[model samples]
Target: MHTYLGTFIGVLMVLTLQRVKIGPWGGTGGHAWDEGGHGASAGGYTGVRRMSIGSSWCVSSMLFEYDDNGKRVKGTLQGERDNGIPEEELDFHGEVLTHMCGYHDNHLIRWLQFRSNRNRTFGPYGNLGEDKAGWTRFEVSMEHSGSIVGFCGRSGNFTDAIGVYVAVWNPERFYDSMRRQGVRVYRASPLRMDLRQIEEEKKKEEVERGRLQKEIKEGRERLLKLRLKLGVDVLQQYQEIVQQLERGREGKRQTIEELQVEHEQLERERGRLRKELDLKRLRESRLEVELNHMQTWWSKITHL
Candidate 1:
């Protein structure tokens, strides 16, 4: 009988696990809703509740139906919670029970949280301890009857926590609904990361980098050519300057030679002027002597 019941519980656990599809068994961060009843009515469920969402089964709330022998008979799943709620609600909210977080896909990305009374800070199946308030809850297992259900143990717990619970919604149904609503779900397997896409991306980046390097080399060559041309022009300008200086020096030498010739001609003219002055003086003296002799002869004749 124990074996049959254990088999039954195993089947139920498998079903619940399939419904919640978080990576393993771990609790997501919990969100405690406002007890004042704002977020509770947003989704048409009364009484604000806390929720935890993650990629593992630990954050999902599990539901079980048990037999009279305290054995689990059946199972159901809830959904995954989101981070949309404020941080103040994190401690009180428990793991969500929903199908949205199951199936390991993003189509149904919603999470689940426990729904209970205002002052009931305990989680699903009384897994809460006295000091476990205000913490995210994770449901490990559950033994259930018609009305009273108790979980095996709390997987995630917090000390001095205000409110917390374990909760989960069915993920398969939520994913179906999302598909009906035209939401696309990528089937990317977390187990197998695609290396092809990564390689393609690397190749593209390499091509682009190669192109950039080629452009840089071409630019450097062009700049070198321009510099060489500028140097050639500077050398030509220096040559022209040297030629002009040489011509200027030659002109100065020619002017100095012409000045020397003028000096010689002026000296010859000065010598000729001195000779003419001497001749004039000689003629004047001879005329004076002849006049004196003529006056003396005229006197003698008169005396006779």
Candidate 2:
């Protein structure tokens, strides 16, 4: 049994090799298979084949690969380098890309097909003149199969307008290069969030934010009030100090005036005392002269 299984596996490998040599399956979906055949004959793609879709306002390019049957197998949606797709529109682009490439069952012809059928889906806005256009370009391989199928171009008319520009690539080479560079790919299922739930959460957050803002404002107001009260107290204290200084200055002034009056009275008294002393000295001098004369006369009488 083991020998039989080995033989079968060997035969399958031979068939696969033979198929690779012959070329891939015929192209489908209206695109010609002749180019695809040539690529398969070359064993792999030599360069990049790019395709641009949509008008100037909402436009994109895709690098992609078709399976043996010419159906889009895998691709990469790329954004412009300079005027990149708006960050808000990234999720919308990603969703569309995921549906096209990740979900293998979906039929994706153009980027516009990826837009939601609901009314007023998001997209880019403004005049779609040639001057306002931006594009993203990538190469698709006709040789190998890939995980990406195609990308879609879309625009939104919402307040936050968005433009999607994508570039697609052959996933086989992309994965091989990543493997060579030791890049690991982790696969996870996409999570769907309800719009109502998102809106509710946003409302809750806004309420909390408002509460915090109010607290901050109240705190500032309280601080301002305290500062004003302190200012008033300081002004009152300053006024009291000025009043005390004024009172001190008036008392000093009155004391100086009293001292000046007393000084003047003392001066007058001193002048009167000095006049009395001069008169007394003059009387003493007269008495001394009279005594001298009397003595001289008495001496002469005694001699006679």
Candidate 3:
């Protein structure tokens, strides 16, 4: 009987893994960030309740607000701002975030799109990167009756990378799975660092340290040989010119994006106003006809 019901749950309804983790997809330029916790309890449904994103030409920042087993969890903003772009808030209300897809340049996330359980599509938010050929697309989603609960990634001045944690959302299945197997649901916590994961992380850190050391060694060797080639003042002047050019280019791009967002808002306002004007004209026509009818009745009474 137990085997039969387990099979039924697996085949017909939600087959949930303890944790179905996807990726930290994006650039390698920033500090690693984790807002990962999928509310991995078999007692209740858990999912992202809302989200906010700040973007311009690139994704600047993101945050997730989660409802984890009746408790509210608000995640910190994941990245720094590159522009003065306003943040866009997406209030899911009660709907679950089911799917996410985005594109990333080698250095930063460029575009983001989202779909909810209500069949609503949120964005193709940022523009495609200038080098369209170099961008890579990625997707993370909940399988079966599930929900995406958390996010993790790398980010610097902009959102450099992104990822998600998925959990089964069927409240009935949670207790049934636990009771049938006497199995403990897997839980992920930043506080709980296992030894194998720690060792792997240490190895990565060592490799990065070695790479930086090698680069420094090579730079020193080159410097020793070509130390006298350029005067310090001349080098400073060159660097200043490069910085100026970079700042100017970046400033211009941001200005254009700001104007575009503002213009779109204005267009929507204009459409709303036009509809209101049409409604007002119809009301006036109706009122004018009623006035004529009253005047005609008054003349008949006076003639009598």
- How do the residues 92-195 of candidate 1 rate in per-residue lDDT, one tens digit apiece? 11221222111211212122333321222333222223443333332222112001111221222211112111111334554564446453432222121224
TM-score of each: 0.31, 0.34, 0.47
Per lDDT, what order, best first? 3, 2, 1
Per-residue lDDT value at 222 in model 2: 99
lDDT, model 3:
0.66
lDDT of each: 0.35, 0.36, 0.66
* Of 1 and 2, the candidate ranking higher by lDDT: 2
Using lDDT as the measure, the top candidate is 3
Please name the candidate that would achieve the greatest TM-score relative to the true structure.
3
For residue 183, give model 3's deviation from the true position in Å.
Answer: 26
The digit string of per-residue lDDT tens for model 3 on 1-304 reads 4345333333322234344345667789888876654233432225566677776788878877775554667888777643564444434334556678889887899999888755667777678656779788877554344556677888877888887765554646543544464433344432342333566678989999999999999999889767756566679989999999999999999999999999999999999999999999999999999999999999999999
lDDT of 2 by residue, 1-304 (tens): 4345323332332223111111111112222212212223222222112222332333332223333222233333333322433422212211222111111001111122222211223333222334312322112222122222222222122111111211113345645653564434322111111333356568989999999999999999999999999999999999999999999999999999999999999999999998998988888888889888889999999999
Q: Which residues of candidate 1, in runs, are more than 4 Å off?
A: 1-206, 282-304
